[model samples]
Target chain A: MIRFDNVTKRYAGGHEGVSEICLEVDAGELVFLTGHSGAGKTTLLKLLALIERPTRGQVLLNGRNVGRLPARAIPEHRRGLGMVFQDHKLLPDRTVFENVSLPLIIAGLGRREIARRVRAALDQVGLLSRESSRPDALSTGEQQRVGIARAVVGRPRLLIADEPTGNLDPDLSLEIMMLFRRLNGVGVTMLIATHDLALVQELGGRRVILEGGRVSGEQD
Target chain B: MRLWLTRHVQNCLAAMGRLVQRPAGSLLTIAVIGIALALPAGLNVLVRNGEVLAGGWESARDFSVYLKPGEELAQAATLAKSLSANSNVDDVEIISAEAALADFQQSGSFEGALTGLDNNPLPHTLVVRPRPEAPASELAELARELGKDTSVDQVRLDTEWVERLNAILEFVRRGIWLAAGLLAIAVVVIVGNTIRLDIENRRAEIEVAKLLGATDAFVRRPFLYTGFWYGLGGGLFALVVVLVGLAVLGGPVARLSALYGASFQLQGLAGSGALTVLGGGLVAGLVGAWFAVSQHLTAIQPKI
Candidate 1:
């Protein structure tokens, strides 16, 4: 469902962030992208999310070159993809339910559908009882789950999580990973970028490792 | 379609709810903006009143042909007849020296002096009222034509007062425009700065929304609504301020008019002026959001 052909992203001052990185993910497959800081993992996820353009390569999703899509069309393209972040970037001003309902709202879903989907997503994250609670009231792990619920509430074809468990304890990290595994079993293509080698090794999914701005290893 | 409407309505309500969450801050912001908008709105009302005051001058298109001492009544009568025959002259009133003296005596201030006079020194005058609303240039031309008649010693238009009043009105008109222009700039800056602060405070929310597949529009909708409410509240407050000012000044205005023995009403904003104020406020809010969105929204990215 996702492919990259010689994708190169060079930052300003001629710094190569991601150099000629080529990779592919089949439908409903789960992959872990393991890399240290500044190893092009974030850049690859950003490229697939259409947040940044590849400098000298094609990034395709659903067999279409998303790198070539016009800026105005980027929003529509993003509708098919879900993304979660390390910061647990839930809006503190919004209630947990509101944060989760945001993606459905963006997709122009009916209010009844948004409510139904948001309740279901919150239920999945074990946050149904905390729907009316603001993000400020939630713990870090709970906030991150809110972010995850928001990402999946739109029922996107692909889900990308960037350091999804970075701030969590081992137990919470494992639980989050288990949530992703369950989601993948339900046919959502998943790509997780993380520093937790032990967890990825334990899960035994396809692995793509990055080093010096290039994909150094791939294994299944 | 119905779904989209429902979501947008919810979004708008959600936006309004967020604004209400900080009620004190919102009220203070609205007060600041209202003060800015009220100055221009108040000045607009004065400008409209000035127009009405000038409307009388617009219609007072008349000239008086005053005869010299020793000029015979026959000569004044002939001149009056000739002036009345002119197409530009709407009507002429012949004021003989005897009749002029009688008018002077009727005024109490000059009654004692008139009683002691041996003979009336007042000259025979032909009061000429011109056709409806003559331009200044046309009146000047008519005066020149009347001055050429030897039977008349001078043609006194009494337009000097009109000219001075027009100059003052012109100054006030230009002053209103300057005030309105400066206030508009102030409005934009006020709203722009407010929106900038909001963007800063909600930076995390914006990034979160972007990660959740929320487009620029979806993220911007609430901020835009915030600006709009600010403007709407400010505009309504401004209108109230103007009305209150008019009410406070109304007594003095009425008293002055009574002293002058003339009827005058202080004019307030009518249809177009009110609409302009409301629309201008909305536009200012929208433009302010535009500046903030263009500057800050692009800096946020969906990240690792």
Candidate 2:
């Protein structure tokens, strides 16, 4: 479902975010992307999400060159993939239900369908009772759960999470990782970027390691 | 089809709810717009009333032609008859010197003022009324033509005040247009600033929405609707202000007209006029909102 052919992204100051990175992940595959700070893990995921364009070479998703996607098609393209950020990115002013309903709302879903899907997503995240509570009022883990619920609520075929467990304690982090494993067991493809090698080892997933601006190794 | 309508209605309601949530700020903006609209509308009513009053003085457009001293009454009568037959002349009345003296005597206040004269001092005069549709310039031309006649000493038209009134009315009309235009721009600026602040306050929410796949148009919908509501409310308020102004002036205007032996009524806005005011408000609001959102929304993309 994803392929990168010698993709290179360079910043304005001549710093290389990622260089000549060639990678592929088949459909329905769950993979971990591990790297140290500034190792281009976030930049790599951003390229796949079409949030940033590759400075060279081609980035393909579902057999289509994403770098050539028109500006008007960006939202439509994004709607097909769920994305999670380390900060949760939940709207502080919105309730948990509203936060989760954002994706379906953008898709122009009917109110009844949005409500139904939002409740189910919240239920999956185990925050069904806090649906009406504002994100700021929720605990850090709960807010992260709301963010996950938002991402999966759209039923996207691919989920790209950038350090989803970065802000959580080890216990909560494990719980969140277990949640990702359960989602993967149900055949939802996921590519998670993290620096936690021990957690990757514990989860026992295929790992793609980045060092400096290049993919250093791959392990299964 | 129903779903589209439902979403639009929901968006409109949501916009209204946001305005209502901050009632004081919204009300102040609306009141400013209302006052701006009312000024021009009230001036327009004054212009209308001036036109009506000018129409009532149409008969005063006639000319009084005074024949040269020693001209015969018979000559004046013949002149009046000839003027009456002219296509431009509606009618002509001839007043002999005897009749003029008799009119002056009947006024009582001027009873003996003219008695010392051995003969009547007043000359034979012909009052010439032009066609009712005659323009002031055309009537002035006719007056100049009459002055060329050897038998006439002077031709005096009582239309000077009417001309001055018309000039004043024109000046006022242009002033009203200028005021209206400036106020419209003010409305746009006011609404644009308000929308800008709203966007700023909701910056984080907007960024989150965009990240969640919301299009620029989808994000802009609520702010546009907010502008719509503001314009609508402002227009209605302006209409009320104008109507109440007319009502307050109506009684005094009627009394003044009665003193002049005339009946006059203040005219309020008809159905179409009210609609126009409301429509103007809506358009200004929509345009202002569009400008604000388009400028600020692009700058608010999620940083990723």
Tens-digit per-residue lDDT, B185-266, candidate 1: 7877888888889988888777766765677888888888878888887888788888899999889998998998878889
What is the C-alpha lDDT profile of model 1 across A27-54, one tens digit per residue?
9999999989889888899998887889
Q: How close is chain B to the truth by TM-score, in each candidate?
A: 0.83, 0.82
Distance from true location, Cα of A14 in model 1, Å: 3.8
Stretches of candidate 2 exceeding 4 Å from the true structure: B66-134, B150-154, B255-262
Binned by DockQ into CAPRI classes (incorrect, acceptable, medium, high), candidate 1 is medium
Instruction: Give the lDDT of residue B87 in candidate 2.
Output: 77
Model 1 alpha-carbon miss at residue B203, Å:
1.3
- Residue A136, model 2: lDDT of 86
Clashes of each: 0, 0
For all predicted structures, in order, the TM-scores are: 0.87, 0.89
Q: Per-prediction fnat values?
A: 0.64, 0.50
Q: Model 2 — interface RMS deviation?
A: 1.1
Which candidate tops DockQ?
Answer: 2
